[model samples]
Target: MERFFTLLLILVLSCGLAQAQQKHSISGKVTDNTGEALTGANVYINGTTIGTATNAKGEFTLKNITAGNYQICASFSGFKRYRENIELNASIQNLEMSMEESTGTLGEVVVTGTGTPHHLKTAPVPTELLNSQMIESAAAPDFINLMGSVSPSFDFSPNTMGSFMQLNGLGNDFIVILIDGRRVYGDMGGMNDLGRINPNNIERVEVVKGASSALYGSDAIAGVINIITKKSKRSISANHNTQYGTYNTYQSTTNIDFNSKIVSGHTTFSQSKTDGWQNSPYEVDGDELVETDEMTQNAYLRRNVRQDLEFRISDKLSIYGGGSYYMNDNKRALSVKDYGLFFEDFSYNAGAKYLLSKSSNITFDYTSDTYKYYYKYNQTKEGKYEAGDYQLNSDQRRDDYNLRWISKLGKHQTITLGSELVQEFYRSEGRLQHDEESVNTLSFYLQDEISLFDDLMLTAGLRVVKHDNFGTIATPKLSALYQLGHFNLRGTYSRGFKAPTLKEQYYYYEKRGTLYLGNTDLDPQKSNYYSAGVDYNNKWLSTNMSVYQNDVDGLIAYENTELLPGDADNGIKKRRQHFNIEEARTRGFDVMVDVKLPLGFSFGGGYSYVDAMNLTEDIRLDYVARHYGNVRVGYFHHWNNYHLNVQLLGRLQDDKYYHEEPNAKGYDLWKLTTTHQLLHSNKVNLKLTAGIDNVFDYVDDVPYGENRGTINPGRTYFVGVNINFAN
Candidate 1:
């Protein structure tokens, strides 16, 4: 009895000691030179489970930290990491940090389509990584603007309706878009309109500069873009941001997040509006096509809401689901100024994922988008009645479900098996309502990545798909990467295809009593892509380059037909027929360099040049830019909580047409930004930024027959403040 009482007393004393405050909590925020919250910034103590991620508001909280002198570090993409020593007190302590932009290691990973994740240096395909640092450097209102600053090989034209992107001079439809590795089918319009995507909800963007059809199937002949969204990492989180920019434009975003080991979810809300600009004076002279009274601005208002939920059913099995609602009301001066091109779009999506095992997982995903457009025409002084008023309504809905399995079979072997089923329906209503179409696709794919040796890796994949319109199509890819000393070399060959758009198949309309026709017979286009690249990384410098060629078949073109309108009173129906060309070829070379200099300064740049042509037309394809380049430089001082950055962008394409008139000799844009920490405390940060788009504001003659040209945006400026309040 005496021994038992002694043991009980010892247990009671241990419990009493545990109740005392032996461990404290440390938390704070991290910001960039522009006072923008940085996500994915890693924070941790040397060796402890007491580490936390910065919330959406850039605030991080670490609990159960033993009171002692410890070293804390914070790191993010495209920026230098921060490390400091702090003394943890019995009470809560604040340990704030500021990171500077640096070209070194940008410390990024890329998902180069095909479900392959690898470090940028070791990726078999040349991939580009754009993190929050690069996105903020551009100060763009939407994803379209952000691409101009982050992607050197990409071209983005953001109209009020939507934003389109092109890579290596390829058609916009040639690329594939994804959100967190799930297919994100864009609008029915020609361009995907990336502007519809809210940038605030994104964590990073990954780009594969060459064909990715080894996994993505059609619409991946040119390249692939994967947008990674934010994940729940905080116990509770909330963020709000509002911006007023030049040209009567405003943007607002808000998000709330909650995360724990067992349950996690996030909610996001955003709104953006613009009152457009006028360019009537620039088109005053020459050419009957140029109207002096022309005044137009691509104005639009957009709203989006999204929610994500994740549940950890067990140690080996997890489940996740998410849904989003997006709406856009857009107005444009199409055909005539003040005619008012109006469009409304609504889209929703829900998806779920299941963890089959430690090394394998499966996902089921679906998305639907419904959209319509209305155009109103006012009376024209010319009695000719040239202004045609019409309402065009279209509905495009796609449902896709896919199952993917991944296994790390051995130390040197990783295998993936996947199958996807997709159904697309498109219907249009104008003067006449066109019948709907259902295109179904069933695809099966298998990929193997094997480590041939200590320094060599090989990847082989094959995809077979059966489509309602194209029958059966097969694509195969082979790639190998060799690591030799400090340099890595990669070679790849891939095959891809792009299906015909619905408009090319069964589109028909009656304009002013003139009946238009659509071609029922159309063929899917196929392409073969080849790429060779190398990357070199050292302590202070890193460089990568790739040269690629694409051979395509069945290039679609519009030809003038002899068929004339039977109704003479009605206007002629512009006939755009679908026919296949024998051959089309495109070749390009791209290069990127990152340099880390002395005194906390770093710089990086990229360049891409493409030459594309059609054998039948013997001319460059429309809307393909020949040259693109981008560069950035930054200075970081973590101790003082200060940073500075400068960025430049350029684009060039000589050929011009109504669809390609924006193509001009390369022009340069410059931007500058800086952040200063408050002397009193580190919780408050002030940022100042200024940029001159089209720095020279040079005006050039557009390909408007004989009319003078227009000028791009002149200059813009911005200032912001960031604050962090936490335990």
Candidate 2:
């Protein structure tokens, strides 16, 4: 490992020194037909990776461009794309461009669907996009809640185990979450820590539904969510945001950035805390009401800090490194329970990219993630607490390495090839009988995107994975898109496979009068997914409708069984073990429509219907809703110095079904939010936001172990302030 690090460093230094000669730069401004500055417009050198977005003043600068003649393009949603030729001769170039409003969605760019970037209107697969403005308008505190509010095919419910997420009727175990194109590595009870993500630092989020195993690896059977973080272009920039809400809840985040021609750095710190709340003080134990001794909290206390640094070796080479630390503490009621749970995570990553040419690049990345859990006992013995006797419960670690190359074959095709290696280690005192366990997975994938005709596109991808315990498997996918006058029709078919997790093959524990055991002879889960969608965009209206079906075989589930061959005595009545004995199918339809009204107002909403069933057992899947929908209305007003925005959001859902528990009741939730911009100067800005969630004060008083219709803490109010400065 030391030799490898040394060799990589030497290579980067040599490249930097060899390419440190001369470079030119370009600066420009983008405006609309009426000469109004356009903020957040995309400007790039055509067919290259060198690009930048317009700042608040509609100004952008592309530095370190080699002296050459090239075509520069500027684009924005709902606007016509503009392109012009420019020549650079060892000097800076300044230019100005304007765009006209258009009734098309051809300007939006997406990358998650095919592992390559493409305009949304021309991409061969369907994808959903949520920009920063939409995320801020909803006032969501975490990533899970943010997604649940904007997308109809996504849903979330909070419980003690974790926040359960369902994407198009599939559970969290089947979804892949990526941060800036890298996978998140830790999970508890099949739920990743969405709180680790800072919403304020996110620039945009892209969602691709259906099987994506051909691009990503396992756990992508349901879909993939890629979060892109903000990058700074200015010499120096800083932002601070803070919020306070009911139940003594508090949140604060601070970010700092420094950028130069050769180096750029970013650092962010965030903290959140809540005093916790309870909806009911009693529980139904059998037929009588008994006093409860637990508190219901979606989350307790969390803190996270991350830092990243990038070095631009030249116009064709770059290197970056970053690390993050996260911690969370959850406390139960002070009644009968004598212990609480605490979690900690540490992550580090480093990567280097080499631009082979204007339209090709190769990247290599390495990442390490560690997760730890501790038990805090509130008992005392001999003038000291007994927490030390049973402090550490579980420790898990993962190391990943990835290498990718992307090349533009010609004016009509692009190809991407990548390989990934992952190593996982786990140790637990209470969950596993053995002291430690380990697993390894290696995978390679290739993707191709081709423009078949004037208005037709095709994309095909395949992946092969080799697991230490499961041998080798292959997955493939194909998609096509055809553009009409004002519509985009697309269809996809993909194969997916998910190998059993280490915990599922080695875990052993007892809870609530039931003993659970893991099986080592489990087969991997396999699925075939099919989907089709139509998108229509025009001046005043945009709509989309999609239908999808997924059929899965060898689904893993827990089943009651007789005692094992060599079972030890434990205080449990029932014995259960994980087995691949179930087959299932999930079929769903999603419809959404957004309309721009007069007077700077907009109205949009969506509805989703799903039928997830177990084919072998002839029963409905657990924790699935048959019907769900959301509605949104917004108004915006801008003056000379500031702007005011107001929005109302509502969500409705049908009853959720479960196997071992009663059905959850249906409910509706409403929220209202308003943002006021106090300052909008070129170098400084200030904004304030106020919101009320659960306006009707709806709450589910169900016990801790049952399925809850809604986990809201009744009516709550919050206020937030954000300040930004740049130079």
Candidate 3:
């Protein structure tokens, strides 16, 4: 493996050096119709790979371009595409372009569904996009809540295990989460620690539904969510944001960036703390309500730091690296003694890219993530509790390496080829009797996109994976899109597969009077997914509707077995084991509509319906809701040099069904937020925000351990301030 990588590196460097000697460069600036600078606008040569984005001053430079005649274009979201003809010579060429704002969604660009960039209206596969405007308007504290509030197909609920997340009736174990194209690893009781993400640093979020194993592998059976972070192109820039809310909740973040001709660096530091609240002070024991012995919600504190740097070694070669550290401390309140749950994570990544020419490139990246969980027991001395640590519960480590090559074959075709290697190691003193266990996976994939005609596009992809325990598996996907005037129709079919994790196959534990055991002979799960959708866009309105069905085989779940005769006298000792004994199906439909009304007003809403069932037992799936929806309204006004905006958001859900407990009732929630731009200047900007959540002060006081319709802590108010400076 080492020799192979060494040889590839040598080949890439040689090609880059040869190409560097005979290339020219292009420089330009992009602006709006009013001659105002437009930052982050993309400027590229048509039908080629040479491209770059405009800086803070709306200036861009595309280096290492071969001398030729090409069509140069500039594109930005909510703006018309600008094109110009140019001829490159031995010297650098400079130009300027202007664009006009549009009221349609056709200008948006998406990259998550296909692993290649394309306009949202022309993408063969369906994709959902949420920009910074929507994210900020919602004023959500974390990623899970942000998604749940904006998307009808997504749902979240707080629990003792963690925050339970479901997408189209599928659980978190089947979903894949990515940050800037890299996967985020670490889960506590089947839930990922979404708090580690810095919400203020996000630029956008993209969602792709149905199976995506052909491009990402394994756990992408349910869907994929990719988060893109903010980037600055100024010489130096800094931002500070702070928020204070009810229940002693606080959040603050600081970001700094420095960019030069050849080197750029970015850093972020953030902290969040919340004194959690309980809606109920009672518990249900069979048929009676009793006083609660423990707090329903636990308080938590989190701190995180991240840094990234990039070096442009000539125009044809660039190297980048980054690392992050995050820690969380959770406190539980009990009548007897309070216990603590602590978590720590450390991650590092590095990557390099080599541009083969104007239309091709090869890149390599590596990442390592380590996560640790600890339990602390407070000791009682005299009349007070002292801080004392107890045991290390679990430790997990993951390493990944990827190499990819992308090229434009001709005017109407593009190709992508990639390979990935992943390694995982886990140890748990409470669940596993052994010291540790590990698993490895290797995958290779190929994808092709063809522009069959002016109004038709087709995409095909395939992936082959080899796992240490599951042997070999194959996944395939096909999609097509047809555009007619202002409407687009798209369809897709895909296959997905998932291998059992090491912990799921070897761990054993006892909880709440029940013993659970894992089976080493478990079979891998597989699924077939089908989807169809239509999109309509015009100057004033945009609408989309999609329907999907997923059929899964050999699903893994815990089943109750007979109790041992020797333990019958002690109590009702039930035994549970993981088995692949059930087949399941989930079908859903999603509809969304947005209209831009007159007088700086906009209205939008969405609805989702899901039917999840266990075919083997003819029963409804647990934690799945049949119907859910959201509505949003906003008004924006600008006077003189100040801007003001107001937004109202509401969410409603139908009853949720479960097999082992009572059904959860339906509920409604509402929120109102107002933002004011106090100052806007050439070098600095300041903004303030205030909001009220759960405006009606509605609360569900259901007892602990039972399903609750809503977990909101009634009416809450918050205030926030943001400051930015650039030079």
Candidate 4:
């Protein structure tokens, strides 16, 4: 491979020519808990990037910085974060910061758990953050209602042909979605399109459950969800947001940012729509029960746009490029005659980075993605389909190449090296039985992190893969951390894999007269995971508890097979194919909590438990739900221009197990949110939000093709507006 990228560009220019040092400065102001004066707020000096923001009287200086004991962080994006541990040797004046409205952000900074960067209370893995004030106090409208309102071990399963994600009971091809850290492409059956992500352009959310597969390879078996977006560290910035509700649902977004002196820019636009509703219009007509207008959630529209650029050829190199465009439409059934779906996507990326000092760096990335799936045709249909005919149903493509290095080898060791390449192409011609297929993967990975002083930490990783069609593979992982004193203790062991998606081999479909087939000799789905966690944070509580066990092998599902040679000459004698599944097990437990009280009240919640099994047909894994739970309550106040927040959220689940008969009824839902920061200024900012989702009006109404729990249309109300501008 070009002499291994010319020996990694001569070892990243000999570590960017060794070093440079001598610098100092610090100054700050930023305030919030009743002292109010937090304009723009961001003040940094933790692991370099020096940083600043706060002006307009919430003052901030932080200049050249570099001499000694660090961690002087301060942040503000819906409050709560401030860290201190200074000793900068010279130049320090003023410096006093505070932030509140706490919802527990354990000293921020997380890099999706050990891909580098840690702190979310000393991470050695076992991460889960979700910030931006718990997604604007849970007035969610996207990313599947903000991961079904503040994730407690997420499981979002919506299906009418798409939607999937489950962690703890592993599914959807075993989880791994990312943005801003790449990796996010296509899926409809194995699920993607979480509406092309835009929770008003999020700024936080990071979860790392078990099996990182030696740093994200082989699909990370059931972990990783990093979606960090939203950037604007001012030179200029602009934003706009919108929202509307119930059965006419809507959301809109716009953003732009630009910085100079060496260029940086970002632009985005978003739109989403819905006119969907219905909860059981009666179904099951074999033993009698009728009436239908189809749509227990289906009526959609989506659009997204993105553009980016960056160039700063010095200060240790930088380069970047970007592109995106996406569209979606799914609206069918006012009673079915079927055929209403279409998707479009196009993506592009380019990258470069260098800075082998100050806690190292060297990165390169290239990505290309394409997705298309269609059906369209909503009118005159005859054999083989017609009318507005679009019919293409599947054609996905993806490509990626990444190279990385981060080295710090002195002062508590850190090392990481990586290389990856992946390419996939698939096409369906009326649902494949051969039209096109391709796959490739190449990987190399190594990681190390150690601290051993001031409380233990350790990480180890290794990954090696080369698969044309499942050839060599190796994965390993181990992690540990121990703090004690505000407690933290963690552990992990991993080896995970999942390969076998190309619509699980190959396919041909037919539904409602039943018949489906696929399996070109599939294999590759392996795992072994184990975990343990315990965390307890201070300054008014934060808690975490975890336990996990996974052991999967083969596991591919869809059985019944017996015909597919012209479907038994068109007699179609029982067909369903896609095999595997010999043993499976998923065990879980997670619990989390937050608290912070004293005049402004706060409380949080969590609970999740999953148990999946099928040890050679012992059963219990169909639409799994062993138990689940959720909750939240909050209040905040500060009025200098108008700032208020009130929140209440609750969720519950249980009973989603099934060998048969209705199972999928487990409910409890509530919401009441309010955020008003009317007009706060540095340059300008305004916000308003209101909500009342499902609140005491839970509906499972299940009767339309069974299995249900929440298509939530109970009590709904919403309002939103956000505006910001800075210079």
Q: Which candidate achieves the best TM-score against the true structure?
A: 3
Q: What would the per-residue lDDT of candidate 3 be over residues 57-146, giving only the tens digit for each residue?
A: 888888777788878898776786788878877755457788988675567778998887777778777888887778888877667657
By lDDT rank, best first, the candidates go 3, 2, 4, 1
Alpha-carbon error at 125 in model 1, in Å? 3.1
Off by over 4 Å in 1: 1-103, 157-164, 280-296, 332-352, 371-392, 431-433, 508-517, 566-568, 648-666, 673-688, 699-711, 720-727
Please state the error at residue 689 of candidate 4 in Å.
15
lDDT by residue (1-727, candidate 4, tens digit) is 5356556655654554535677777886878878868766777665553465676678877666657777787876655567788877887998778787544687677887677766588878778888888887886887877887888688666766566667777766788888988878888755777888989899898988767546568567788888999887566788988989877899889998876546778899999888888877887755788988877788888999999998755446667889998888887873486578888888998877777566777887778889888888777746866667788778899887778888888779888888887888998876776788888888898889888987988888888888888888888888888998988999888887778878878867776555777888889888888888898888899998988888888878777755656765675656777888878888878999989999998888999888889888888777778888889989999878898999998878877766856678788788899999889777888998988898787777766777675567688898998998886
| Model 3: lowest-lDDT 10 consecutive positions | 12-21
lDDT string, candidate 1, 49-151, tens digits: 2355676567787666667776787767677657787777764445568888754544465666547556566765566787766665565667766676666
Model 4, backbone clash pairs (residues 3+ apart or across chains), number: 0
lDDT (CA) per prediction: 0.64, 0.81, 0.81, 0.79
Model 2, runs deviating above 4 Å:
1-22, 37-64, 73-83, 89-92, 99-106, 284-288, 381-390, 562-570
Query: If scored against the real structure, what TM-score would every candidate get?
Result: 0.79, 0.93, 0.94, 0.34
- Highest-lDDT candidate: 3
**Model 1: lDDT to the true structure:** 0.64
What TM-score does candidate 1 get on C-alpha atoms?
A: 0.79
Better of 1 and 4 by lDDT: 4
